[model samples]
Target: MNIDVLELTAELVKYESISRATNVPVTRHLAKVLRALGFKVEMLPYTDAAGVAKLTIVARLGRAEKGGLSLMSHDDVVPAGSADDWTGNPFQVREHGGKLYGRGACDMKGPLAASICAACRFTAGDLRQPLYIVVTSDEEINALGAREVVDRSKLFADLRHGYGVICEPTCLQVVHAHKGSLGLTITSKGRAAHTSSLKGVNANLKMIPFLNEMRKVNESVLTSRRYRNDEFKPPHSEWSIGINDNNVATNVSPAQSVCTVNYRPMPGTDTNALVRRTRKCASDLGLKCVVHRTGSPLYTPKDAPIVRTSLALAGRRTPTTVAYGTDGLAYSEQMKQLVVLGPGDIAQAHTVDEWIEVDQLHKGVELYTRFIDHVCVQGLA
Candidate 1:
């Protein structure tokens, strides 16, 4: 109950748990702290494609009661640029003028600390239901942690029908929906040939139609405008090329070309249909669409009780939506309610010398404590 949310946030920022760096140490660190706080902690470990170790820390306090509450956060931070570029050590927590400056301050570590502080207070207040702290790794790269949790939902059997709060920076606002995303690096291979002879197939030329086909897909999505939600910017699904990798020489034909395609699936857009149309295009073109990253969009109903309650707590008339993604959407279907709400401005996230206002951190702790009281303690509707 007496937890120093700001101090705890500073301690967490001291860990260099960047996305490229494994989060095992910080996770272990949090696990120890949670254990000391009388919470049951479990570690879910796995190895990524790069052979990097990853972990998901699920800590619970109170009975293993269904319909409990979950406070979610991703522990991984984006890479801090060169030390010379920063005014202070990015890993070392620095507070100046009431702003906590650190790599993950605004991005997530601050919110995670708020959750921990709230959990301590809520536990002391006599919780009727369980309190779950879902700290996942590898969220910056993708929704790896969310996917793992969904796949292994049975591990946290207590919170089966729970509501979720992804502690992503939202300036104390509530977000109920965002676009889902999938990215692919597709390649077309062809034989090399001399420019004048043209004896070999040109991969660059071969890729044009495929590229155009993808453009058509984008155009189709834009024109159809299915499931358009005006709350979101543009209000339409999107498909487009990201990186145009063409292996071509001025005098010789290109033997291989690769390009990155990305899809932002709007809520209600059929992801299966999108992928099916994509694969069909690749199949017909004899190209490969190698999927590299993907995540489900957030579309928690605006009228959900949790959303309505969160809006009321935030003193807002309507639940706004973020254009970017968060960890909650990936697991929204698992629960009756999920909302992305936290302190700090998302605009500050991923910026150099990232910081969260000290006031925001305080407000976050208070907000999370209220949520715990409403959902975890009182079991209010």
Candidate 2:
């Protein structure tokens, strides 16, 4: 069966599946298609803290086995920042000049389409082991979709292979490693009183020491390792703090001071040590620290089969690394290794009028088909 890649991409684009919005309709659409193609489709629904209904679609082909290949994608896209910022409807697909334009045309939807088409090609072919097509929600916000799937270990016991693909916007290159993200919202509390009183214990003032300590911690993170891998652009983890709100009025001492702290840990760095410092600092300062989001950095060896095969398919020997996080991290607990490789450029991912070249879309499908052949059909021979 010949699946129309662009038509699938456009159909997904038209649904307006933003990270914060409901994705059931789009999930059903994908489920219907995968089911028709003889995949055992499973719709696993989950609810986040904010009560948003999310889902992860796991469609498997062939007999279940360990170390099988999996193609993964996220169903959610980043919010279209402003409607006025776009020339055409951001929710609908627009094809012009050999480019397909829409919100997730590059960041994801394009890869999802290509993966589905590529996996569809195996419907009539025999397989020694299984192949999986996984679509999860909440990647743009925090990769909660993949996290949820990973947490459900028993649900994917047979499919928790050591090899997998994260269909992010890698522009057809294979990404073997990426940085981890840790975010927190800290609040300093104190009694609110008239500024005239010196005993008022200003909440904003209580945050000064914490801020200074965090600065030093961040500096230490930068120098964590003597030599950094040039593969990662910055090649070092970064931390920053933002004072969301502080003094509300000149005459009133604020009752609370709120700030956000985010740290991106590079590969080979001890994330637990960094995490402990932030928590200990907040405890010593009598400030409440709430974890907002946390994603572990993924590091796969360059010589890994997934990386080697993908590189061979793309005719590139070097396996690159990305700065951003992906759904791959969600499956780290289950899958032994995961690589981020797909169609489109990362530069166009979150732009107002994001797009993927038609040529890139076709190439993505071809690469995926060839990958299936190399890993599944040839049995990694």
Candidate 3:
């Protein structure tokens, strides 16, 4: 099969595989594409929290051996907030000034297309080892699909010593480290009644103390050197807090209020201690606390074989770190050598009229092909 990176990216962008919905359609399409390229495809299917069916695709070419190259990308993209904000349809790929404009064009689909095209460049007979391509779901919201790939995919299980690349937008730069994610949701419950009768307990009132404590924690995280990692730009763990009350009218007291907290953990940060601290606060306030998600940071040493090879392939002198997280967090558990490298700019992701440079797409294909050649075909690193 002859795969063109631009055309494949446009085809993938046509599928509205938003994080909230099922990614099965786009995943199946990719699976078909991989099969056409003589890849052995495996389907890992699961249901999301909303009871919607989702899928992750794992495809391999050449020998099913212990060591090779694995390229991973998420199939899900963030919601195209409003059509009115875009030049044309957000799902329709449009080329303007040598940039491909679409929802996942810069964020991931373009890099994903480049990976597919690179893998298709060689037939199975030409490979000394295997080449793995993984398409995961729910990367925009949570990394549940990547977790599933780590835990469930039999094909992935064979790549214990393999080199893995998370194809996230990095302008073709190599990333060796990124922050982790820890999320918490706290809920305060109360009885609902009319404010005129003054019989209802306001949930927001109960949540105020908790919020105040969280604010102090946030402040401390922002200022404390203990949570700082100088390798990243901001240096401190980014602590974010969000609040919501279900009541729509002032006449009625709110029956429930929710507070969501998100914290980014750097290397050496004690995430378990952070979770314990939040839980204790919620317990003292008699509020329900739930840990929604936790993902570890991807940390490969700059001298690691994968990082060095990826830096060489991208023509970079050193490996860098990013503030954002990727699926590497999950895959890193199994594959000790992993790096995040791909095309386009991270700034272009999740914005209105998102686009990726055509040159980046072509460069992405070239880089991935070099990586495959170095590892899978030539069996180097």
Best candidate according to TM-score: 3
State the TM-score for model 1: 0.91
**For candidate 3, which ten residues in a row score worst on lDDT?**
327-336
- Residue pairs with backbone overlap in model 2: none
lDDT of 2 by residue, 13-70 (tens): 9888898898878988999999888888877898877898888888888776776678
Task: Put the candidates in TM-score order, highest first.
Answer: 3, 2, 1
Q: What is candidate 3's TM-score against the reference?
A: 0.98
Q: Please, what are the lDDT tens digits per residue for candidate 3 over residues 174-252?
A: 9999998889999999888999999999999979999998998898889988898999988998679999997968899
Q: Which whole-number lDDT from 0 to 100 does residue 75 have in model 3?
A: 88
Q: What shift in Å separates residue 357 of candidate 2 from its native position after superposition?
A: 0.7
Task: Give me the runs in candidate 1 sitting further than 4 Å from their true place.
Answer: 153-155, 192-201, 244-253, 291-294
| Residue 289 of model 2, lDDT score | 86
Score each candidate by Cα lDDT.
0.82, 0.82, 0.91
lDDT of 2 at 202: 76
Q: If both were scored by lDDT, which would come out higher, candidate 1 or candidate 3?
A: 3
